[model samples]
Target chain A: MQQDAARLKVTHEGDIVQVEFTSRKILDEANIAEIGDQLSALVEAEHRPRLVISFAGVDHLSSAALGTLITINNKVKNRDGQLRLCNINPQIFEVFLITKLNTLFHIYPTIKEALESLRSGAQTGRLQ
Target chain B: MRPVFARVVTGTLMKHLKLQAGSRGRRESREKSVGLWCSEEFPSQMAEGRRVEEKILSQCRKYAYGQRDLFALKLALEEAICNAIRHGNKSTPNKHVRVKYRITRERIDVMVEDEGSGFDPAVLPDPTADQNLERACGRGVLLMRAYMNNVVFNSVGNSVMLTKFNESYSSSDTPINSTTVAFG
Candidate 1:
């Protein structure tokens, strides 16, 4: 489940589209757009709309990557779907905690926790 | 010989102190530093650092492990290597980069040399200035000066010589830096 160049693997189950971010350097202003645009196109093409990003492989996320995910989350909400993050590595999760983006996004422990919430009709703390 | 001619010759000779900067970074075991040579044009710059830096770190750590100088040594070396790739060679594959590490009892010296004709290192604008604040570049020079005890550009700036004073013997007074320059 490796995609050739962008260093991410995407998998889908029902309406939930999973995106995993991977790169050697900490995500910052430099290469964030290269990953963001790819995710954007995948979102626009898929009508089902739910997104669960498995952030296990990411080492660090700068402000730019955090903002990109936030923008995508807004777009998903406007479409009446959900955007969540799962399997966040502890290092990157600490970065999110430091930035307080953890307060904004619905973060779950696993992909199943994120997807099952969508299917069961209960909510996970109302997106923050 | 005139006193001024003798004086001129004496001072010019004295500045480049022969503090014995020879011997490889290896302690007695003599394993060469890794990920350091012929890797300027790799597909990813950070990837190159991760591959080489770990090996270089391990080589030094075997001898100088837990010596407080490890992190700064690793960071400054990577930044210098990265700067050689980005600023020196401009990421061009044709150019070659050579990195050599020499560890003396009192200091560790890391030299990064590039094939390109070097620039005047002094002319580089301060990166912390307003216009350059957001730039991803120029931060390496700052880190090198901060981490290394003395940094010198040699062989016409084609190479950077960075030396970190060993922790145990390094003094706050810095006896080598106390000389005053007097010009009327």
Candidate 2:
């Protein structure tokens, strides 16, 4: 197969990196691996990375994708960074709830809230 | 009426076996009872796995399955096929994963088998556990059971069967309490 195109759209706002997925479904193994690598690179570039991942248009994702997110979360934590997820659709959010990942990651309903939470150093709008 | 089976082999090592039952006189009854049945075998490649998954999902779309049902099946199918390819087959060059499924208006049943030594699902650590929450893997089976109506493993653990009832979307809304696992 040919090489995968960039899967993430990354933009930097001050010290925070805002990322979005170009593909609506992140279920493919190769694509997930590529996304993981890209996210890792971003995390490594910052002394204390502050990232917000928006799942605005993503319709589907697999356990492998979730695993990648968790790995990214760990990398950020190790560097004393922060990661926030926002705009997750109801179905996907239920996936988090089922795995109890809703409690592990800081999730917000909008990118504004996530950015604010990161800037304020205070978590908010976490789903119960 | 007896069931008729037709098999077709493609260049990509994908084999499709379609089944239909009934005589000309019993067509209506057969349509009601048999629905659609398909079995396929493909190489242990993610692209091949996805091709087969889309075929199955297209059938669901043809039947006008609800959005929630589509989401549930899509998630469950991805996990099942991924597990079979990556873990069961270990991504061996020549290893193949076989998918057999039956779809009716009321429910869908899928079985995925791989050519490798299987592991016991009972021993998998709970990904939701605090100690394991940060772990980067092992949530596939949990998500499968959560989305599908039933998930069963074979006695040797190499094959798993997943079932979901079409009109039973309410069950998926229930909070995760316990998973139903059976060995056959």
Candidate 3:
């Protein structure tokens, strides 16, 4: 499993791959690269395209992490897979709003919500 | 009559010492401004930028800065430092990037300097524009300005200074309620 190679907790709900973060602080440079690489590798796995990265354990992340997310999103799209994120801290949530990345990614309020939405294949505008 | 003269001399010296003590007090306040600095050599193999960001965030938290303000400071500091290493120094191990910050009760100020020749901040394309929306590289400068209260570039553009004001902080020898901060 790609999650075995990095600091992510990989779970599965039907076809959805839930990658929960295990770190309280994801702002470290090496950790950012590790998470990005792990997620990127997951995206390349055959027959496993849908992803939901849970940020419940993460208090905050660096801007380089943001760039990593963007790169991973691009890679997922190229593979015809979808990626979603959820459980972001309020401070990090504000960062997403500031960078307009909220528009670029499907951000749910919780892991359950993200899984449910992705499972239902519903495209909703959660950003306002 | 001699005793009176001695008393007068003693009073004069005490007054002069008080004056000197007052000036010293003023200088002490100036010195009380807290500062942190880090330097990274070019061609650095590690992501030192992330570690620096974490350090700034920890300092802000220790000072009881509001969560929103801390987030802004974190974003601005990270962008500035990374820009120094990646763009200004061009990741050349031969050059270097230096970061410094001063935090007071009223505000926090930071500076990031790089060894490379600077570019004009005005000439950079607007990252928020439609054509630039898909691009990943240009948002660092934009985020720094958006999150910081003040962003100033030095002549030649090799360095930047960022400042943010705080309404909830009080810098005193005895802080009344420093533990009551909301960290979000």
Please name the candidate that would achieve the greatest lDDT relative to the true structure: 2
- Residue B55 error, candidate 3, Å: 5.6
Q: Show where candidate 3 strays beyond 4 Å.
A: A1-3, B1-63, B170-184
Q: Write the per-residue lDDT of candidate 3 for residues B80-167, one digit (tens) a residue.
A: 8778877888877666666666555656766778888999999999866667655656788888888887788887899888878665
List, in the given order, the native-contact fraction of each candidate.
0.00, 0.95, 0.23
Specify the poorest-scoring 10-residue window by lDDT in model 1 chain B.
B1-10
Instruction: Write the candidate numbers in order of decreasing DockQ.
Output: 2, 3, 1
Docking class of 3: acceptable
Q: What are the TM-scores, per candidate, against the unseen true structure?
A: 0.46, 0.84, 0.75
lDDT (C-alpha, whole model) for all candidates: 0.58, 0.81, 0.69
True-structure lDDT of candidate 2: 0.81
The true-versus-predicted C-alpha distance at residue A5 of model 3, in Å, is 3.7
Which candidate model has the greater TM-score, 1 or 3?
3
**Backbone clashes in each candidate structure, one number apiece?**
0, 0, 4
Each candidate's interface RMSD:
8.9, 0.6, 2.1
On lDDT, the stronger of 1 and 3 is: 3
